[model samples]
Target: MKKSIYRLIKFSILPLLFICYAIYITGKNTGDFYKRFSSPQQNSLILGSSRAASMNPEIIDQIIHSKYPNAKLYNYAFTWAHSPYGPKYLESIEKKIKPDTKDGVFIVTVEPTALMVDKNKPDDPQYYTENDKSVAKTSMVATNPNLEYLLESYDFSITNEFNKKIRPEKNPMIEVSVLDNGQVHGKVIKRFSTEKRKEVNAEKMAELKNRINELKISPTRLEYLSKTIDFLKQHGKVMVVRMPVSKVPYDIENSAVADFDKIILDITESKKVPYINYNNYPNNYQWVDEVHLEPEFMDKFSAVIAKDLVH
Candidate 1:
């Protein structure tokens, strides 16, 4: 009986330990979202969708340190599907930020897509897409080796993550790395040819069109955006920014929501926070797609934002 019990314990405990270790290592090395979850609570944060994920927190810190000393900015931005202004994201943000934080900087990036929800059930929290995602479901966001996120939210296998870290793909189409400081660095291994660029643009346009049909601007989400700003106000300054995009998608967004800028301006005015619309800036920077800024231009963009914040 004693021998059988010992064998059972060995079999179960050993594999469990191995899995825990593998998960820890995987969280440390691979998965873009994993590193964000494993890190400690941030003093300052950059919040938005994938468009804002590539905003380099380190670059922003270096440039803005003189004005706001020791301000550690973490990019808590996820994707359009996961981080739209809603209760789920607000809950996650609340968990990620330190409770006692005062005089912290918060950058909230705005776009039409993020403020949209399913047209059929715009008011129902139960049917929200983000509720099914890690950002909404994960209870603990500031813990090292967040086991809950690794087990539930991590999409890739542990073996795959290990393979990526050990033997990275050579000349891959794209390479993405999530830094300890919570910045997501995505490198385009090679620039797209003219034909390839056209193809990508067409696909993105179609996706945007489909979303326009399926979703609508949510009053609930807009309210949450206000709540997010109000909550961040207690900590410190909150800057609302509208990131720049290429002409094609920009036209579509503006056409979809004619009053988008006015809506954002009203909110900013009411909240008494600065609103910077980079869309009004000269479109000289490169883009990976119609919406996302190219990684090469991220530092320049971050520097511009940092300077704008202080001046």
Candidate 2:
């Protein structure tokens, strides 16, 4: 009996060792590889979902450095990063974000959808990414297998009645960080006609109209949104930025946007925090489309906001 027990233990040990080694390798190779490369001379904390993560952190960093020359800036944008994650990580973030300069700002993007609480959603790297080179960020595995229609699309405008799976992870890989040669790295998988706006807008309007009719926002989401507002208040003045979307208008009366507007209005009014609603804000000549702008426009917009609010 003693000899048999020893054999069992020995067999179990090898597999356990193999499992631990795999986890360590995955964590090391795929984890926030970007953060390791970026110089930590940053002072400001830039937070948000994929849209927030999508912006070139290095640009934001340069913007902060050029505008507020004395201070350094780190782009801490997390993909699919729900606001609730903010308060939880605020302290540790503060540790990484402490700059040589005294005063700094925390710029968090407001993706209205992130305000809704998703219960038990799986992880997804395709939704957005931290490190541009991380494996999940570059994986060929379909982001949402159910939505087979979107596999070849640069189309961020579609919403389906089925489960919407982003990347493999629903949350940001907070354990990993991206470094600051930070530029937004995405491939324009396709470009439509000059009349592309009309095609895109029409597709978006129809899809959202169908989905919005069946949705309801959760209370825990509301609570987190409120907490996020308060968290920003505690840190510095929380500048709630409504990041631009292709933002095709919803059916004016009973569309998906009414739900978003109601939530946005409630958060801003109740919290009384200053916000930049660039979602509906007009785009100038340099815009990539009516909603999102070119990379240079990011600096222009960031500088304008920094000047108007932070400065």
Q: What is the C-alpha RMSD of each candidate to the true structure, in Å?
A: 2.0, 12.0
**Which model scores highest in TM-score?**
1
TM-score for each candidate, following the candidate numbering: 0.93, 0.52
Summed backbone clashes in each candidate are 0, 21
After TM-score superposition, the amount by which residue 275's alpha carbon in candidate 1 deviates from its true location, in angstroms, is: 0.6
lDDT score for residue 258 of model 2: 56
Overall lDDT per candidate, in order of appearance: 0.87, 0.47
Candidate 2 wrong stretches, greater than 4 Å? 1-42, 56-71, 81-96, 99-102, 118-183, 187-215, 247-254, 257-262, 265-272, 285-292
Question: Model 1, 104-139: lDDT tens per residue?
Answer: 889999999899888888476777889889899788
How far off is model 1, as Cα RMSD?
2.0
Q: Tell me the lDDT of model 2 at 126.
A: 26
